[model samples]
Target: MTSEAPLPKPSFMNALITFGLIVVVISYGLFFLKVNLHSLMLICLMIAGISASLLTRCDFSTIRHAMSEGVSRALGAIFVFILIGVLIAAFIQAGTVSALIYYGLQFLTPSMLLPAGLILCSLMSVATGTSWGTAGTAGVVLVGVGGAMNIPLPLVAGVVVSGACFGDKISPLSDTTILAAISSRTDLYDHIRSMMYTTGPAFLIVLLVFWLLGQQYAGNALPSSQLLLMSNALNNAYIINAWCLLPFLVMLGLSIARVAAEPAMLLSSVIAVLIAVFMQDAEIVNVLTALYSGGGPGQTGVAMLDELLGRGGIAAMMWTLSLGLMALSLGGILYKFGFLQVLITTALRRVTSVFNLVVVTILSVFAGNLTMGEAYLSITLGGQLFSDAYDERGVNRSVLSRSLEEGGTLTAPLIPWTTGGAFMSATLGVNVLDYAPWALLNWLNPLLGMLFAFFGIAIFKPQAAPSANHSTPTDVSFKSVN
Candidate 1:
């Protein structure tokens, strides 16, 4: 048998070609006709094959080997995704989330409506470590109430999502927050504390905007009788007390202590389950069932309580976990093929200054959100790409990290196909595009990153300029606003 010629070395041009082919295939598969995920997977494999053959000048076996390695690396993240789902499901089954909502609704009225709604959603999002959960639960009800009060759904949804996302972005227990810290090798609590500098401002601005809107929409207080009616409606649905808040407080405290995310969440889940059993006398078998579907049999007479309480199980997380793994696998293939290296190198060549670097990083993250459709990818990939650049320039890692969070983590929800976007859409019944503009934090983040960079705000580093001739600065003083 004749021996085949050796493959050529991969180049930027080849990487570009590979990326183009992948993009075209995805666009065609997703848009041109309805295709199942299996078909999509096959399409990806075929595209990878063609790209490898032409771009890498490699044999099918070599390409397959790289692809297998890439797919294997994603298993860990897939498991975490499943656990996150289980945690959410457990919280729901235990009536932890419902109890919080029921108590909040008791105080909501036309007078304190806007601030209360914003704060309530923010609190829920912070408690759950998920804006999607907050939006799906309290967000939907707020919209219904808005409609009842003859208010605009889009505007209301916008405020609700804004508040929820703000909480998610800042909350220490947030998955995105955990991912950012881990990806950047920073302490989770430190990162969260650092984020508060910008997050606080952003949150205040969003609240103020919502408050002004409320002034116009919140016409008059629902009379005392109506308030009482609302209270009765809440009371009739579910029993509420201090115990309901324990799981959230425990989770938040653990998170603040910089505890590992999975354990903290698991512990919180356990507390929720125990609370449900002891306080609510929730059925154990029913709790197990609800962990998958995000729904379980609640009380028959109380529609609101049943609907609110019956949500989020392990089954609910499967789709997200599967998609996350698939994206990771695809990303891994691209990385192993040297596509990411080529892209980063090309992007880095143009960045001659901090301003440009900030801009590029922001754009790259937003692009990832648009492409990969997930905040975790955006934060992780952005950190991977930009961390070294920032370090070389004598900039603090926190600056680059916070920028990634602002650009990548918070903005994924604006994309319709993104994990956050899909979760929010499914939960709130609001189109991604509909609330995109109103998601003040999402849009403001990149702007803040750029603004901070240009203004030299909060960028910690050695005072000496970076130059080959100059000796390295020995005294490193870390200064952060938070």
Candidate 2:
């Protein structure tokens, strides 16, 4: 077996200065100079790569190998991105998205739009196990519908993001969920169950907030005519039927059965394609075209309908894929050179109590998200950095996994340059800052996680005796905090 490289012990100040410089430059370029996110990420990667080499005195080949390893770790996530892109296109062509919108509109009144949007998006995301797909499809359609109702676009976007992320954070099909579980060496379902302690309450609170906000818009007039027009356009464009939902249901069932995400999504995409060909009467050439270009040209004459439905092909995911790869590459470089290990180790040493440890873990993962701008990287590295700490503290790995998701998965969408934030902004037509305040669940999750840690609500301790065969103890005893 190849042995691991020895990590350099750089001063904390040096690591901070290097990371801080990259953040400042990227932030200024993105916010002040209005530079493209992809370009900014590339710039940050260059800065981080150069800094690692300088600080660690590592040669180019060593840095390159580290970067390559990081990219390899992210390969699974990259494939999921590509598959979700194609799956989205298939959903559009199969008329599944249109059917969802059409049916959803019938039940949602203008006054209840916000809460209804949250519920719909949450269900869709949970079912599909993809926040990006939910955002691009149902999330986009809601924006158009909200526009017709004169509802605040930012509020709508916030609700959508909140719901989508909630589902993504906990769902079996979600890449973030799987990544967190694997990184922490915990069972997928166990990780998800542990998260429910925090996620469940946060989601309930967000629902209440949205419902209260909806009451303020209770007197707003519903745009019946515009909605009817869109509905008519949808009916005219494709075959809208219950069968269109079959692919989604099949995917959900597979996820529940613990099938791997890739195969489940692939099967779902195939089902959607078949539906488009036989039920929607789409030409095979048109289906192929949609698979490449997102979706076939919008047949709906309405501009909004055309814009909403005319998205999804494999090409649509290139921007996110590029950003993810670059972010992972930078993460790989940091990990390989021991920059991440040194930084995290420095932070971990200061924790003297369980609460402090949990807090530090949260902050460390948050920092990773800020630095790496990718959920998978943050979760993977956060788990790696804190796994030993949790074991030493007699804490369950589930708690560590939950903390990683709380810090990494929940916060990624709030950073403007991150993959989650960029995709949500691009797909939903709202700036990350504009909708962040309203994405209550995203910010609330971390706070709730901290609260749980402080109060010892769900902080579990290992059984009295360690298992002889297991590397880490599994049975946990729930402890109450003083």
Candidate 3:
């Protein structure tokens, strides 16, 4: 906690310089040098640590604690990452994924697939309040289906992400939703309501865009011959039937019932592995091997089917996990050293109106995501950073929370190094940059939010004067951001 153990306060200029230095490195390495995210993040971690030590003059022990605390805070997400890998492999082995593909092709057409997928993913994410789970399970199915239909995988991935994040932004079950509301000291439902005004419109627009674009690409559908080839390969490889769907149904049911994601996913994977061995007539040795390395050689002789099916496992997820760890540790150092704090504080001091406050809130959280390399930290700290400005301007707390989600929650997955981004890339098999252009809902919401703020549409009027005792939060120990 800053109140309990404050580091030497960093100057705004030093903080800005350090953050800029990191941005340059990330841009150069990510875009020009074409370095992998894991290596890029490692470089960043070292740079951040060194900068923090020089600017804040913090002891090595404090730096180590910050690094440890960063990863520790996100332990739940790390566990979920490992489980997602296991679940994907198990689902493929049990014919659950194969069954979906085999059956999905019977109904889904290239012309309507984008809009339909967006709606389905939206419903699932809302029900489960989990974007990652929705992306891992349903998103994977949609990507494979898109490929079978000869639709561009990046476009399909973008639509899937847009829909998955829609529920996460406004759903009551979402951790980011709850975190934003708590941080802003607003009612949970109030935060949700505020979000609906922007999220609803953005979602509809995204649906329309994908629909129109999908129509233009309908001609790209696979020839009937190729489609039949894929269908036959899947049919020959696994016992595709309704029984295969049971594992997914059970996982979805548990998630909607408020069971923890970890337990729900683990239980589902167990069922899937059992079905693979007994019902699918797969060898136990092969099943266990698939559980660790995704899978061995493909069951189907078709190159495309084999390629998609032969992915998942702990080893497959290591690239994402390692990158996320580096980013989190670097974020911990930045947060603890007060680099972000000084910059956000300086920015808040210049806010002069309610509209400015709203726009700043959105941009600050977006910047927080970039500098902190995670949405949780941005959402939590953005609340503390801007609550006073909103209070003084007579803006509703719900607006502040809505801004947090619009910026932090929506933008995190578009960045390549954030935990959200890494998970999406690993699960969906598309680079963030590739799909970012198509994930309209994620970017458009913030624009609409700012537009609404400008015209005063849906912006709540202040009902009372600013609280005299309102002050910066003292609970910013960074331990609770998760």
Candidate 4:
């Protein structure tokens, strides 16, 4: 009798289990120990090292292979991170970033300070498709102005970030928004429209919060004297004009036209660099240097502008890319071992009712964001794990997408170590917690999501009946299993 060959061990199942336990550990660490990203990353790597050593029982080569696989999975995100850095640097060296800031500063006055700050930053974020860029440039200037006016820095920074993130979250040009849609496998326009349900209210609420916050200093006029200083600084630094906005317009148009992100970003960077050469007679060496080092300034007197504009070089992105790789490596190791699937399976079994399913989905989405610390993965994985349950309950695709946005996209910046929070904090020079309380949109989001989930508000269902060909015809459909 031929003996059945022993089944090969299921690595993904084991990885899923490992991932779940690690998630628990990370969540506990964050909540109870208040650990930071460096610590969290180390903890995850150590756990992964131990797991591989014990479970794989493989030689050094095998272990290295597993780690390599994990890191390899991170390559795409790493490239994007580096590209963003290069783009930031190119724009700065190209003088586009500075010109935008100079024009923004031209309108700053204490009378409409908060509203103006919000509007300008929001506009910049929408234009650049990056809240971090907006925060780094215009946001920093607003903070300095607040300091000059003896206003609280954190509060001002919070308002600036609020507006910046709001615009970034909503704008079609935003990479994160694109990532969210792509990962969810939804139409970009559809995703944006669906997001408005949560995003619109959050933005209105945040605007109100800023307006109220600004009331304390409502009568204070912007100091006219500083405007001249700013103008002189801009005049001395680089040629500034409406013409500088062409590259930005091109980028924005490309995004609006639904062009893919990587190519669009690259093309925009090239356009910006070309403009820099023509307008400023920028040396080729400076262009190349800026690509790597966030722009080599010939001689810009405004230190703040220099700092703001001189950001986003390829070299500068290494830190973010490394961190992202570490996170993805840990995620891959967990997947390979069986952590995530196990939790999802177990959770699925336990959630019997629609309310329970909705609650669990919201919680799971939050958990994913918290554990993964990246919005793209959170939305993708969370949508994958929960979509079927929603369908079974006759829930809508929009609801699932809404939940992903609420718990995944909006909550990401609240986690200090999460990619969104880390990028924003690093870019804006504000602590995650410092802005957490003030990120009105972020805070209200999960609650609104959960509310809609439980109340069954705004949840849409497909009109057709289920046929043998369709899994759940009446259920709302998602673009992907994720």
Candidate 5:
């Protein structure tokens, strides 16, 4: 392959100005002007691309090539998002999500609802590996149940958000988890195992906190009539049996075995479709429609039942895909033009120790989430920015992967205008600000990651010589402008 012409170097101030302008526009557009996120992001891409070309005096064709390459890198994640949408629809039609909600509601007493909701949501998110799906389905049901029990809606939303984020952080099927591993060039399973050291403790602490808080509502209970109605509605709408869980079990088993995420999800979705047709007795045409447009509008004549069961499909994912593409395209232009390299190099010069390196990685990833309003961009860009620093310090790439997830994936739900936060807020009917304080896991995971770095706990070091098997550090050559 022929080497491309080197890009002109812009001063740090120029780079800062370009980035600052993009952030201001995005922030103002999203929070103040109420512009659609996709539009704002595309605008940012245009501004950044145009500004980079002018400042560097580079050909626009070169910039376009770089942006295309960047988008290509993220294509895997984009496809997975579509698959998740379809899987969610299939699961709903087959009674997979309904079964989870039905069984979960059975054991939820007011006194134990908070902790139970957290645990159940965590299990569902872990099984499905999609926090959006978990929150949209199980989280919504738990919110209704909590309301009936006289428990605080914000508290219930917090527990649900925390559980969903926690499971998403570690699940092999999760898009964020997969993205982090891919960005850092680490083994996917290895990256997951590394997160447990921090995630395990954070989860336990959240469970305990929720349990203690649940005690205040010990005397409150859902009216028996309401409980009976919900249970009966679910039973009448779909087959609630041990068999409904087979798809989830199969997906989880495949994930554990390191099957590629696409195939695993595809197989599970197909299984769910079969169950929907045979066990649930759903019409083939209706099932197919649900698989494309999501299920609902009262199959069981229960408004609540219809709402809870109606979600997912390839169409459902279009919004996320659009945002993902825009963010990645912007990132691509920035990286291609050397803006990212300049910023990362400037930051690395200040790092004198492993602790500093880890801290910088965390901060950079967090900043990416805040500015980009998307986790995929943060993980991919942050990983590219810091891989060299980690390699230079002899830190394991898995640590970088874990750090990206902690800062980018987990924190996404806490930001009001971010994709994750927006989806959760809309899905759960709780504002991001209202539920953020209670979404303990969303904030705690990052702190735990930094804390581990501070103490060097579970931080693996590279051998004297780099292993041939490990991913090479990303190259960030610094060439001066002519």
Candidate 6:
């Protein structure tokens, strides 16, 4: 139901039937039963367990172990998810988010807002190497601003996701970027450079489209009187100052320095809390409370503004965190029982030519994501599954790495059940289906990558290994769900 289920080592047909039933159940529940993702995931787990019990030869303990192993793979992401919530709360309490909105209103025209937001999210996600952080912080603020500007919420969310993922797909600091390279055994910088051929053009096109889209909203700009009201409310809620932005600047500097994300974010949160206390004169207890559960009904006194600011904190991330765990667990069951391997291996046999190989790799990524519902597993298994195939064809591993992120990282948020999709929906408050069409970069990059394969543009032959690269993957952080 949530991108993973109990697929056992049954024959291919049985595996297909097991998978199909889970999909049908999820579709039925979502389309008619109207169940939440977490609850539906639980049902999926139960269905998988029953399938395994009735269909597979594996025992009960093995099933439990499989699920646990699946969840363990996500520990790094879970750690960051918790930290991002705290960081978001600190930013809000420190008046950093308020100041951004207030200042943005003063300078940015309606026609420029979407483009600006796209660029802003791109920079933050690249700097932080975390799409979740960008979405939770900058994405939240932009949603508020976009709402005030009368832009469609879904469109704003799509732009935020597109930009956030663009950076997550290519940033040197990104875990997905690092993971893709490591998985394909390609040099990190080489992988980054190779992606430029495809991701670069795709992102530029996406930017252009968003710029054009911005023009349509030009006439729907927020009225000066209403803009003044929101700005006044922000001013009244907290002390808006240039100095309040220290946390963000600090985070940016640390990320650029490649000091791992966890410590950098934690340190930035501390700075934000201190600023909130000293500069804004917020109560220590209130600030701490906000850290745990967000500021309730922000003091803006305007319903819309109040709703925008009244977000963040550990509690807000719980739903996303829980869904992520369930997804992992479901993926684990299928993986442990060999369902995923059986199906993917069946598909890999058809790769006879370079173009066929490219198409298969991309489809395998989608297949792995759809089956496991976890991009990390998709990339990992995809790398393991297709590494030799790329070598046999004389293509460089960087291309394989590029394909992995192009599909695994970028499209993760397009699927409603994947953690990336779930996180975007939970954080940005838009359905994945609603934003998928507008998340042009996320979907288009893969097509462009495939186009390169069709023409043999940047796809290079294997190179001799020589130089010592220092950029090893130290932080096995979240899969960009990018």
Considering every candidate listed, which one attains the maximal lDDT? 3
lDDT of 3 by residue, 1-482 (tens): 34655668778888888889888889899899998777777777888888878866777887899998878778888888899999999998999989888888888889999999999999998998899999988999999999877788989999999999999888777888888888988767777888999999899999999999889878867788988888889888888889999999999999888788888989999999999998899999988888889963366888767888988888899988888888889888888787888888898888777778888888988887887788988888898988878877777888999999999999999998999988999999999999988888998999999999999888885545434443222321111111
lDDT (10s digit) by residue, model 6, range 1-482: 58765543667776777677777877787779988877878888887777777776667887898899998887777787788789888988898888877877788777888898899999888877878878977898888888888889899999999999988988887888988888888788888888999988988898899999999989976777888888888888887889978988888788777777788889999999999999998889999999989873256778867777777799988988888888889889877776667666777786678877887888778866765778888888888888999998899998999999987998889888888887888788788889889888887899998888999889988988825754534434434323
Cα lDDT of all candidates, in order? Answer: 0.64, 0.78, 0.85, 0.65, 0.77, 0.82
**TM-score of candidate 2 against the unseen true structure:** 0.86
Q: Give me the runs in candidate 2 sitting further than 4 Å from their true place.
A: 1-7, 123-141, 172-194, 295-299, 388-397, 426-429, 465-482
TM-score result, candidate 1: 0.72
Best by TM-score: 3
Reference-based TM-score, model 6:
0.92
Candidate 1 achieves a global lDDT of: 0.64
> What number of clashing residue pairs does each candidate have, in the order they appear?
6, 2, 0, 16, 0, 0
Quote each prediction's TM-score.
0.72, 0.86, 0.94, 0.78, 0.80, 0.92
- Among all windows of ten consecutive residues in candidate 5, which has the lowest summed lDDT? 473-482
Q: List the residue pairs that clash in candidate 6.
A: none
Q: Note the residue pairs that clash in candidate 1.
A: 89-312, 291-313, 291-314, 292-315, 294-311, 294-312
Worst 10 residues of 4 by lDDT: 473-482
**Candidate order (lDDT):** 3, 6, 2, 5, 4, 1
Candidate 1 structure quality by residue, lDDT tens digits, 15-104: 667667766766676668755443564566676567767776667777767666654643444454555566666666555555555554
Residue lDDT tens for model 2, 1-482: 99976767567777787678878987898779988777887887888778887877878887788778877876766676777778778888888878777776777677788888899889977876778767766787688677656678899999999989988888766777777777887766667878999999999999999999988877775557877787888899888889988877776677556566678778988999999999988888989888878754366877766876777778887877777777778777766665656788988888898889888888888888787667777787888888899999889888999999898888888887666776787667688989999899999989999998999888876545434543331232111100
lDDT of 5: 0.77
